[model samples]
Target: MALDALGSPAAARDGMLDVTRDGRPSARIHVTSRGGEGRALVLVHGAGVDGSFFGGLASAFAGRRVVTYDRRGCGVSSDALDGDWSLDAQAADLAAIIRKAGAPADVVAHSLGSLVAMRALELAPGLMRRLVLIEPPLFVGLDPADPVFQNLVRAGQALAKGHTSTLFMLALERENMGDAIRPFTQDELAFRERDVQTHADHEAGWMLAYKPDLARIRAQGVPVLLCMSERSASTYHARNQDFLARGMGADLMRLPGGHNAPRDYPDEVATRLSTWL
Candidate 1:
């Protein structure tokens, strides 16, 4: 990747850093760093998306160096996502991003990225000085026997048959997210198509692996900010929000828009983040 500076002096410089384990390539994370002297701020995007999703939060953190990266298989990174994609592997990738950012950084993650960030904290707690999770779907306060799980299972089955649009809409309906996602622009829909299956793969593995025993981690261990959307449709997401705030003693943040608040209301979310931090 070219180390060419961005058009603006303050624009982040894009690069690719290899995150390896046992001297083998684990992942090639695509990163953008707005270099600064202070501790870095790393933003991890959610499922079916990449770091560009954090474009809204960029200027809000101008004074400090902020970094963003694509998770494995989601964007321009390596899709070495065969077999079971355990949360451990994803978390290790996150930790590597932190170390590449010069370590000891503040982390802000959204959706599935929240799960990765939390596990990263557990893997290398010292890398995070502060953490923020936005509408994490940890499935707390959810019954294992609920039909929703079966619906989700069926959705995955549909994905295996190369039916993306229907599977996606079904997921939105199940979350009560409505038809707002319909009428996608050509480019937006293309991006989603590339992302949805990788997301499904990760979700499948996450279900089989992580136990969602979030209470095992405590608020006292690290400073945490728990953010939620005032309009998020998923009841399970809300449950996780409340559970994390109460159990982790996290600072509660209610933002505009729904589960993908950062993407929907970039300016508002960025402004709030600036004010809070």
Candidate 2:
């Protein structure tokens, strides 16, 4: 786990891993390895979207082996659609990938992916060196009957029902994104459209609860940095941030964009995370 400062960009190595779960071919994860090995940095994406959205951000960490891969049943990964799709399952998948990348790897995850990353931490605490979580809605300190939770359910349903625009709006509102979304770029709209088919797999994660023992994480000396922004001022976000900062001794980083900061402001997030790393 000898980590060096971020260096120049290296050529990417792309491959697909035949990763297994329950002694079966559960996933064929499409992995992209950017830069060369110094410290392995694994980027875990949230629901509905794939690893492709992380291209811009991964490039910033040039030689530090920025690894981005689609989770099971999302993007090009195999659809183990029958089994449990909860955070626990996702954590197992993450553990396999982290083991592939080598131990004590640095992980940077966003949204739902952050939840999976933390679950993996619980499952294999020694597998990770540190974590950079971007607006992970852990739903720990928040009420079950809260409006944000309701909106998230709605967003998931909207995504399942092919209501793409409605899903987008609900996602923004859930993250407390302001009045902007007027004209989505071609790339922006296209990404959502492409993810529509994969929404069913992600929607299941919404039902899962995240109740990590913060003291244990802190005791392990595994540093966790929770990154959010002014725009991501939802109650869910605030509660989790409070829990992590107060309970886990985790660091809080307020970035410039919303919960989707990793995709929206990859360069800025990368710059901040690189310096922090």
lDDT of each: 0.69, 0.71
Question: Residue 23 in candidate 1 has what lDDT?
Answer: 67
- lDDT, candidate 2, 1-277, per-residue tens: 1111122234576667765666776656667777776668999987767787687778776667888887777666666644655667778878877777777899999877887887788777799899988877666666668888777678767767767678767766655542343344453455564455555445433533467777777777788898877676654787567866877788888887666667667677788888777
Q: For candidate 1, write residues 1-277 as lDDT tens digits.
A: 7323211234568877776776677777777777554677888888777776676566456576778877887666777634335788888888887876666778889888988998887667678878888877565445667666555556567767757666666555645232243243353344565566787755544632355445545633777888877776455576556656777768988888677777666667877876666
Where in model 2 is the C-alpha error above 4 Å?
A: 1-10, 143-172, 176-194, 205-208
Runs off by more than 4 Å, candidate 1: 1-10, 35-37, 81-84, 143-170, 174-191, 207-209
After best superposition, candidate 2 residue 71: deviation in angstroms? 0.9
TM-score between candidate 2 and the true structure: 0.80
Q: Residue-pair clashes per candidate, as listed? A: 0, 0
Estimate the TM-score of every prediction: 0.81, 0.80
Give the clashing pairs for model 2. none
